[model samples]
Target: MLGVKKIGWSVLLSLFVLVACSANEKEQSVSQNDGGLQVTFTTPKKVEAGKKTEYTVHVSRNGNPVADAEVIVHLEMADMDHGLNGFRGKMTESGVYKGQAVLPMGGDWIAYVKVKRGSEKVTKRFEFKAEGGMMSPEELEKSGLHENGSLKNPDF
Candidate 1:
């Protein structure tokens, strides 16, 4: 029937709209390296807590891609008052450095990007809110904190 077909199309359109809206909810942030190497980077639009999130860093100096540079990412949930061990990045064939970082919890976090070339280093920081699963006990234990949930290194 014509009415049935119209209803079917309406349902399909609603589903499409929901999918599109969901896709837009993921948060992404970009930062420019401030110290030296003249690099910029993008973290995933959305990253699940307790899972590995891909980090893509484009390194360049004077408009040319910098090669053989070491990229390190130090992630910390400043709101949660803890820091990750940091992730080491690898250079891709396209001259972009890639790294995977696992954020332990969902909250306010800061990403410190450090790019090292020989003895020179460049650094940048990005702040963003993460949306996803809660941190497990195992993950919290591994964080730099005592079993009582106190910071192991308070001086930091």
Candidate 2:
């Protein structure tokens, strides 16, 4: 009976750890207008301190890619009271926009992504955490980016 109880506890602990790890791997997304417009995007999984990192955003409306819209992001550390860096995103191709900015330190950050289409626009916010330091070339390669902060493949 003692061994059976121990196995149950171990299984519970393992499940807890699996849940925590998978939470971090999930993509964060923000939606507005009851899914009328949205942004499905990817930023650098992590960033290095004082180093510039690229954020890739893909904008869509009614399940279709929005190509002519302008993308911008305003980022700030959520855990601290301080000014933040904000930049505009440029459309690369296929409704994908990319922007590069440097995060000052390692902490939790929030990004307000704005997508402007014609005379109308929508804003969605996403939060992500990162550590300090630049990523190595190999790490960048695995991240679907090149040394110049551009996606290595057009399909990326």
Candidate 3:
């Protein structure tokens, strides 16, 4: 009767609204590169302990960049007194994240990269070497200097 028609219209309208809202709520953060895949890291791979370092990640396929992707970074050092307790980063840009981590000491460390785009996820691990002896240019030259402040073995 009339009540049945009204109920059908109401149900259809509710479904439409739900679909529209869900479409707007989709959270996607992954970009496609060229034929291959690549992630970007803004921070330097070499850093001194206790110093802050930042990094970022991006997805690409076929040498083209893909936009809007979620990337996460994790750092771990085995020699430090703290074992994986201090590590965190934020995704500041699309398919990019900034990270601040302190190099525990001079040794080998493991850095992890995790990226997600829709249902696809990529994870990679990299090894980093940290050491002491932060020297100036003058000091470096001095260390490599000869007795006469010239080349030790001149070849001319």
Highest-TM-score candidate? 1
Tell me the tens digit of each residue's lDDT in model 3 across 6-88: 44653464455445444544322233233345765443634443444555555565555556656666666543332332233
- In order of listing, the candidates' clash counts read 0, 3, 21
Instruction: Identify the runs in model 3 with alpha carbons over 4 angstroms from their true place.
Output: 1-37, 40-42, 78-81, 85-94, 133-156
Off by over 4 Å in 2: 1-33, 133-156
Give TM per candidate: 0.66, 0.62, 0.49
> Top model by lDDT, which number?
1
Question: What would the TM-score be for candidate 2 when compared with the true structure?
Answer: 0.62
lDDT of 1 by residue, 39-117 (tens): 6667676665566678787888767788898888777766444434456778985448887656654555677888888
Which pairs clash in model 1? none
lDDT of 3 at 19: 51
- CA displacement after TM-score superposition, residue 119 of candidate 1 (Å): 3.4
Give candidate 1 misplaced runs (Cα > 4 Å).
1-27, 33-36, 138-156
Lowest summed lDDT across 10 adjacent residues in model 3 is found at 147-156
Ranked candidates (lDDT, high to low): 1, 2, 3
**Candidates in order: C-alpha RMSD to true structure:** 12.2, 12.2, 25.8
lDDT of 3: 0.47
Alpha-carbon lDDT, every model? 0.63, 0.62, 0.47
